[model samples]
Target: MPPRTIKAAIQDALEDLPEKKLDKFRSALLDRREEPRVKMNSVEGKDYITIAQVLVSTFTEPRALRITLELLREIGCSEEAERLGELPHEPKRISVISISQSIFAHGPSAGASAGRYMSGDKHFVDKHRTALIQRVSTVPSLLDELLGRGVIKQEGYNTIMRTNQEKMKELYAGPLNACGPDEKDTFYHILNQLEPYLILELKSTK
Candidate 1:
């Protein structure tokens, strides 16, 4: 019998994943393929590496390794991809605290500092309500950047924005009726959910 191709092997491995996760992998893989290739000698290549490293860190080790292999294959690095596939598959245990620590370790310039601020030692929204509102207002721009970079599909982008709009409407019933603490808290919770997407957008932009 002939050995399976790299794609076939990947598909076989993905069969164990839930439909939702499988869909995400498929979409990300397709999007990566559609992106223009960055030459290794170009300045863009360094930026791409930085973005890719940050993006992959968001996933479990197994998923990250699989995606890295897929990306290598997409970029015509079949030999490296094959070698990566042969490595031991050990999933790293990640937590919100650990992720926040990693971001903070990079210092303020990493742009990931915002994430640490939001998740770290204190709740920025609770402590600085006015500033939080200002940051929330920038969600639209972040969504635009995410869509432009193909980090999110049009459908996903529309869904997330629409949901955010609905949340905002509820949080801001009227100019006279200011959002109560509870409402503001709920909005902050939604922002936390969207933080990973925002982080990916930031990494790509840098």
Candidate 2:
């Protein structure tokens, strides 16, 4: 059989982490809401609580996911009320679905009692792989747009194309498939590769 790919290797590495570690992480995050807030002092040396920062964090807190949904509904209500000078005449119902496929595209799911962690990890890997392809699909269009707008000069167009083609080969169209590279790492790689060409392009424009 042919050798397994790098993406598979990375997935195996991530999945092979002891379940004990995951259990510990889950336990730690469970009570994270009760953790003491970080304190800071103003320039005058008076202690102050960053209420706005705390409120933003609270809204996005793991414990506040449902609350955030409700708050979004509240905001929509307020907007409509301001528009009509009153509340909605008809009650509107909103529903949210935290679908597995969608969450897996970004990271591991957090659904408890779903038995998904065991299988969802694999789904996450597949979704991550597909995401890399979707990202690569943007490279050509980005290049074309840059060329069309004269952002990337015609003389250096070949250089940009060659660099992007190499990236495509590294990510896809190769025996070594890189399907599961995290979005952060993929973006980092893109920035690293494109930085030099971008610098040269900007220099030419100056």
Per-candidate count of clashing residue pairs (backbone under 3 Å): 0, 1
Q: RMSD to the native, candidate 2?
A: 23.7
Candidate 2 wrongly placed segments (more than 4 Å): 1-135, 159-206
Top candidate by TM-score: 1
Assess each prediction's global lDDT (C-alpha) against the native.
0.40, 0.31
Q: Report model 2's TM-score to 2 decimal places.
A: 0.16
Root-mean-square deviation (CA) per prediction: 14.9, 23.7
Q: Each candidate's TM vs. the true structure?
A: 0.23, 0.16
Write candidate 1's Cα lDDT for 1-206 as tens digits. Answer: 66554344444444444455444444444455223432333322233334344334444334445455545554555565555466344222234333333334553343343433443443444444333343343356434533443333454323343544443343333320343323233333344443433323332331
> Residues 81-162, candidate 2, lDDT per residue (tens digit)?
2322122221232211222223334543333333132224343223344433432323564444334433334453343334
Candidate 1 segments exceeding 4 Å error: 1-47, 50-177, 196-206
